[model samples]
Target: MNKKILIVEDNKTLAKLIAKKLQSALGLTVDVAYSMAEAKLFIARYTYFIALLDINLPDAPNGEIVDFVTEKNIRTIILSGNIDKEFRKKILKKNIIDYVNKSGVDDINYIIHAIQRLQNNAKHKVLVVDDSRVFRKQMQTMLENLFFQVISVAHGEEAIGMLKSQPDISLVLTDYNMPVMDGLELVIEIRKTYTKNELCILVLSSNEDEEITALFLKHGANDYVKKPFSKEEFSCRINNSIEALENIQMITNYANRDYLTGLYNRRYFFDTINEYIDEVKNSGEKFAIAMIDIDHFKNINDTYGHDTGDKIIIALADILRSSTNPHDIVARFGGEEFCVVLKNINQYSAEEIFNRLREEVEKFSYHLKDDKYINFTVSIGATLFNEEESLEENINAADMLLYNAKKNGRNQVVFQA
Candidate 1:
């Protein structure tokens, strides 16, 4: 949620600096309070994402502000000039996110980083697996406080089923001691579907044995956390794993996607289509392959320059994307050309679908730099896949039909039934 963060500090200078830093860095609305009274007023007036509370306020001394804020069920971060270990431990015992020593700019930087982490955590969903209801609830509470969408399961078998249903899960936090199946077995099973870079698996257990850690890691666990983990440790590990996963996926996308169109590149398209063919070879699922190219694309590039040509390409990609089913494969085969697989469809229906797509393209307009609009059209050639033919052979037939469409006339769909 894009919400406000409340800063309750008795130091006006420090509070304003924190507010400014937070506002500039995160682009979030921040309210600064000079004392506990002012903080209470802000809290009653507005709901905050999280509250940053100073330990010793002008009116409420001895870190009483922490108690008041936490009692209100607000997630808090304690800011104190005091750095005594015993005092820090006592303050952290409360439900505050972290105890920050207000030493200087570094402490302010820490707050910024923590807020950014929490914001990024919102885009991720974490699965919590534990046989014990108490532990499950505990992990769920912690994960939610850290801004994750959490789904907790009692054991490995249920976790597997949940993962199947929720394929978008980013990470799994599983406990080793569980019924139905253990964490190690869960790790092995999950790895069959998702790779280490695609999904992260973290094992949590009371067993501090080194062998258990090795066993989990060897079996595909990304990392291991012992029982009674401090909030900081847990947060760091979880965020690190997710960060790594995102980085890897980003790199993979760059490799497998067309940079300009954001569609599957030719290499990935063929690879995916080949896998689909293998899956449906025995099932007799009908599909159609289509080759599409813009009408007179090179002439447009010559008249308007390649920059405008790129814009036209991107616009056509959007049309193709919105016009197709989610399960359908749409890829940018190359410059000014694309490919699509109409899955679970007959020849007649596929022809109708492509004709509608062609109509949508014909009726579309791209506004030019001179306040004028330019209209473009495309020619599509489609054919039903023949089980007797190889993937390359079927594609070649579609390509020949595309040539015929270009030869006969552009801006139309040609289907070879």
Candidate 2:
């Protein structure tokens, strides 16, 4: 399909000429609007891939038209006769893709090149949550010009559903003050379910006061942009916020990873288990937990020193990690202790996995610094989590089963009744 371009220009001759050139050169179908009102009407009536806009129009001056176009999710190139350097600088700050002063044929050609560039660049996906339709539309425009797929919701509830539907959303721009659920409340709810890396949030505020900014940041917002914000400045802040989120996520993944096992650490394990419980609670799906302990670990530690014990632990972790499927949650619970939480599996399958792990652990060998080969074994206890059971109860049941394995001669697997 040929790209649609809306030309918001008061000069009929210029508008027609630009439209002709764009249609002839770029194979674009152009729509002309002599005023902001007509432009808005055209916008509501049809979807334009891009908008060629003049900062000043008869109905609304001072780039209000640009703001309107931006809200509509239309990529815009400012085509204006206005020569105020300060004003142009201000619009550039708002993240409008490009600004071209009213010029000759060459400038129009440059504008077409800019539009082509916008089409070729990567498209960011933004979810805008705001009670105000006005605000949502504004962000939609700015984002579209930068080649972003934009989804806007008028309230927090709708925003949540939208986020659930589009899991790949790159960022969310939400208003601080709104009906039903406000921005801070929304952020809190989202954080409770999703990781900080999974979603990047920015609070929009009419008030740019330090207290207000600090309050939103405290509530887990990535950043804040004041209302009546300069376009260029808002763009810079959003880009920086995304970069910061990527860095933070990288650090978080490393910090929550076990050094020896390459599995999740105790902290990440706990966090993930809780999240799993939350997910299963709503679905009533059956899950299993297993507690594993290296049998006679203390004797090994005393006989070969702590270094040998450490090598054995690392080797055991590697065995368990390689034995389990990707869906399985294997973690070094602590010391010689480890745990696995299997989802969508019943007690029988859990016991089978437990037996397999026991056999693997028994067969595994480790090497000490003196190049001496050492063999070790592990005991495991498994339990099925009931819908009514707490995580602690589930853990206790698994631990008790592990104790039974140790009691019934080590290197065995036991299941809770």
Candidate 3:
């Protein structure tokens, strides 16, 4: 998507103010055109991510610029001062994103938020389930217009299967009545596995029965949209649902992550690893659990102060996060101590992995004031998984080896399988 915007407003002062805001706030390229003629030239020269068009312009007075811009396949939003009910209604019918009254700075802020919303919409996928092929296509069109990745199915059963295969799908829009599996049944089936926080479900039906609406909401449907809805209402509901889901996920991530390093916290690691362990435990595969600690960390902190010491810890965490495979787990247990799990590894490979990690930390340089630098080293201890032992035992075994490594010398890896 182009990081550029075209604003066609006749008022020079208002146009420049909005342009400044778009450029400064969004870091986007802004092109302002005072009339339809200039807009045509700009549209011909550059492909814009979105266009803000004025209904009344010097060259085109009767909202002719809107049709011209829309014909160029540019996504448009009207920044018009015209508040006539008939004119607003007619202009909105064009495939434009929105109509914002150019009343004050408040409207400019809304435009900024709307652009941010559109950019985020691309991250979500919406599943549309309707028995009528026509309705399915209509919903698909509207969703795509709002920049959402859309998947359409003819019935509710296919919707379930799609969710299973594509669990990352963020929202489901289903018609209440369908063959094989009705929308209500689909909602119940979906709630069996996914929570409202995990997935959003909205029912779309022509039926206005209040009892039916209550039943759908009672059975895990986030919302119900009646058929023949306006584009503004539909857009608002979908955006709000996605934004809510994003907020919930942000909070969940904050809870499970370390504050400074942004790695998985100790609690999250232990809490989530059991299911993975169960899956691979009986596969006759060997795994390595290791304890890593910054050697003489207290001395460094004492000499450099706690702030620099925190910097070193953060640097080491970055190394661990990047050096390991994506499937491998790395966590900060607290202070200068860290833990790593090398999945599906052999005895020799595990030792080599830990040794490489030790070398990486030893060579890293943490710079201080002037040209001075602090070189740090780490101690590592690793143990292979034992079929008969609990996870705690394996961790204890590794911790003991870490102790031995520090005892023998401060910068070494002690491996015991």
Clashes of each: 0, 10, 0
TM-score of model 3 (CA atoms): 0.92
Q: What's model 3's lDDT at 172? A: 97
272-304: candidate 1 lDDT, tens digit per residue: 999999999899899999999999998999988
Tens-place lDDT digits, model 3, residues 49-119: 89999888988998899889888877889998888888888888888889999899999999999999998
Question: Which residue pairs show backbone clashes in model 1?
Answer: none
Please identify model 2 stretches exceeding 4 Å from their true place: 1-162, 166-170, 173-198, 202-221, 224-236, 243-284, 299-305, 325-328, 367-372, 386-394
TM-score of each: 0.92, 0.48, 0.92
Candidate achieving higher lDDT, 1 or 2: 1
Ranking by TM-score: 3, 1, 2
For candidate 2, lDDT tens digit of each residue in 32-130? Answer: 999999998998889988888887788888789987887775667888887788877888866467778887888998887766555543445788998
Q: What is the lDDT of residue 8 in candidate 3?
A: 96
Candidate 2: pairs in clash: 70-141, 71-137, 71-138, 93-231, 93-232, 93-233, 94-231, 94-232, 95-231, 95-232
Ranking of all candidate structures by their lDDT, best first: 1, 3, 2
What is the C-alpha local distance difference test score of candidate 1? Answer: 0.91
